[model samples]
Target: MIIVDPSSGTSPDRIESFSLESDHSIIVTSLEHHVWQELEQEIVCSLKRLQCPRLLDSTVLLLHKLITNIVRTMHRHAFQQAIEDDLNIDIVSKDNVFDELLQNELNTHGDRNIEQFCRKNHFQVTLTFPEKTDTLIRIEYPESCDSSAYLDSKLAKAIGFTLLKQTDTITPAYYCATVVRDIAQHHPHLEQAGHSELLLPDDESDKVLAVFCKLNYGIIVFSSAGDILSISPAILNNLKLEISPTSAHTLTGIIPGHFYNDVLWGLALQSQGGLFENYRIRIRLPHDDSLSILFNISGYRHHDMTIHTLWQIVSLDHKATHTLAEGSILNEARVHNITRNYVPQLVEQKAREIVRLGGNALLNEECRLAVLFCDIAGFTSYVENNEKEESVIHTLNMILGRITKAVRQHAGIIDKFMGDCVMALFREPHKAILAALEIHKHSYDFNNLRMRAGKDLLLLRIGIHWGKVVIGNIGSSDRLDWTTIGDVVNTAARLEKNCCPGAILISETLYEITAHMDHPEIRFSKPFYLKLKGKRNKQAVRYVQTTSQTLLHDIFTTHHAKG
Candidate 1:
């Protein structure tokens, strides 16, 4: 235990001695009110000299309550004896004699009796100032008290105290009071609940599960009658909702019109003892853009037979696949038991692994990688000329989705989506070229669908380049994106911009690797020198045309004639 001595001046030894003596200890003997009053006064004086003005009052009250609880737990038999001794006197027969005798005995020998009890029961209170960044107040129970027994007792009922349980091995038993800063940092809601009184959670398992869901997914818990019990902050922020005390929000109020019915159906299925997992739905956003969301529902039966439900919402935007792990589903019969028993162990293991492996060591690296860029040709003009923004966006997403699918199918990483373009990275040059060819073929299929729907045909332009690029996390500490950057990336973007619609372009470096491969369905244009933007010298490139190129051109010609 250590504390800075404000009074000791010019002598390090004196300061160290004062700090050592500053630790305060009190022995609990009986539940007599006067004993605690004197002890509280001593503690208050010591706190006053400690110079923590902001926390002085709260700490004093907290310590008093904690000590009182300790006394009540350890001195229950002594209290019962005192009360029984008082009850022995018959008040109706000799009230005056009883009062005088009891007062004399208590006044003369109460302190001696308390001292004897203190020696019998090994309960003592000690205040030690540990060297820590944050202020802390902790209570250590006697070795005889097991962790469960201590936690079940009144001493552990205080809110904002973390229980460090004892084990058969090394970990000792203690529960420490949460300092003000710790509370604000870890449990901000408790501060808003007010400091006058603190409330403990009814069930610790529920608290653990709530935290896990809040961190990993956007979750909403509903009551039996569909009232909103709790909702994650991410959901509120994503949906732009304002929940207040006076107003109420319903499912219909928060969810988009297109996806609301699906959500309702999911809830109904769960209520009927059915499992709903990965129920995919599309939600249209402003500007006619849409988001792919997957809903998973879990249900719980309360002691009163009321059925409650929890909805785990995961956004599938930019994800390569739309699916959830089978083991991730919460088991209806063992959800509580599993979460209570295993979640903590899982969290600890993950933390240790992260520490063992330097957190960012694997994510950031320099390697030889392939960069591919795909853009919709004339998308800006299409959006401006098309009055129905919905159709324009729908067409845009269709093309982008096709490109994303092709990239993922070829084992490429989708770095990011920029407006109408997607940037992806791959390890092998052949895979990048293959993915580009696949995307080019899919464009023709998309055009056929548009032709049937009486909508204008859209074209796609793709570019591929292979070179040494630094692929790692970029952005501020708070928000980061795993992306690639180098001359290779810029060159790919330029190639995409220069390529004609319905064609795939490759840089000389990338073409060298695939030029020898036998892709009978693909036709490579003669290698030519083209001046690319942001380059001092002209770049050697070739346009790779698939077998569907002629069909795409025929469709374009027919569409122009129809228009």
Candidate 2:
């Protein structure tokens, strides 16, 4: 089991030394110059110590396999150099300002005016790649002068799969002329080539290095059986794409081949929760297809032997089923079956039920409840000024998720989202008040982060009221909406309008529930009179501040206790 460790180093010097110290029979493959000789000796010493029998546990193979796959995918030239020099495998990109590099090059070396810039900077451009391979190509102008800007631009451009090359030849004063001249003489073929065949060596030794180098951005897929299905190096180093070992049992269709059934069984066991937590299995693939058999192996990050073993499990073509009888990989079809069989059909059934309850559920006599309302201040103006519709929506969704979770944590049911506003109701004043306070606290937390980023602040205005309200389904016969009505909701809206940003304001009725609870944590202000709309007498109201330490603790403690 020869394990490849890409993290070890890819330069030619490191790789050559690694082979020298390996079992003598393993043989010294090829040697090229990707890195200097100083670090090459260190790798040789480390390899000698590691070559002993059983020096590295079997688990290390997983990372080795992953690295091997990556090296196999590298540019042929990079592979050759590593093989020649015994290089260290460093996958991290050295250039941080790739975006700036690309942009600067674009403006300066663009086809429209490249001649002038090249002439003044003593630069020459070459485009020698065959038409079949050179789909998109550009030569950067050396006169861009700004190192950071140029580096950033180049990095950004190279982020996606791209054939990239850089040389000091662009400048008149070559930094290392002697070294460049040697490479040009010895490897004259690569000097004038673009998308050179060097990335894909035909020989076995060269091919191994080439493949590993290409593994830079690809996803290495392994089956449950610990067999490799595909190594997609193109996507390996990308920042935008996220690749991880996600469970494939939930995936649709027959699971692909080249995986392990044992690992799948292990994952299946884990999913079973407390009942099967300690379960173990010694069965092989296919023959022992009982759902009772499962495993509990550790997962690995690199392409090692363990991961290859896992690949075998997922590779089962006709293994098990969703049924408890046939311990299958609980594939997508099974998940859909369960969802369709038990879950509610909210889109079609909500209206009919709303009508059956009443004209307006919240307005019903038995529906006395507390209502909470919150609105994002300055939302309308912000939307009008910002042209980035997607960014705005993404941020809004994040805020809503946080607020919604807080409300649900306190047993509050969301009614509707009005623009950036949220309407919720609770069965008891305690839950309602707690939910409102949590919303304020979470909103403050979210806005604080936004403030640091120089983004617009999301200030939440909250209002709560508790009173007799009618709760029923309201709307036309064909489209009944479950909602609440009555003076309680109206009063809550009034309270919201009265409060400032970042404040959770509640009416007098809601506060009455906790006034005598004798919780030292609950902080409040004395009752104040407000001339509310549609009321003759000045209504007595007290605003409760959501920031009280006691109130915060009460919400967390209640939820934690239940969990």
Candidate No. with top lDDT: 1
Off by over 4 Å in 1: 1-363, 554-563
Q: What is the lDDT of residue 120 in candidate 1?
A: 44
Q: lDDT (0-100) at residue 180 of candidate 1?
A: 23
- Estimated TM-score for each candidate: 0.39, 0.35
Per-prediction CA RMSD (Å): 28.3, 29.3
Q: Per-residue alpha-carbon lDDT of model 2 for 512-563, expressed as tens digits? A: 6545445555567788888877778776776665345444434433433353
Worst 10 residues of 2 by lDDT: 27-36
- Give per-residue CA lDDT, model 1, range 112-178, as digits (tens): 4543443444343334434344434334444333321332223223334333433343224333332
Off by over 4 Å in 2: 1-365, 546-563
Full-model lDDT, candidate 1: 0.56
Best by TM-score: 1
Look at candidate 1 and tell me the lDDT of residue 343. Answer: 32
**Compared to the true structure, candidate 2 yields what TM-score?**
0.35
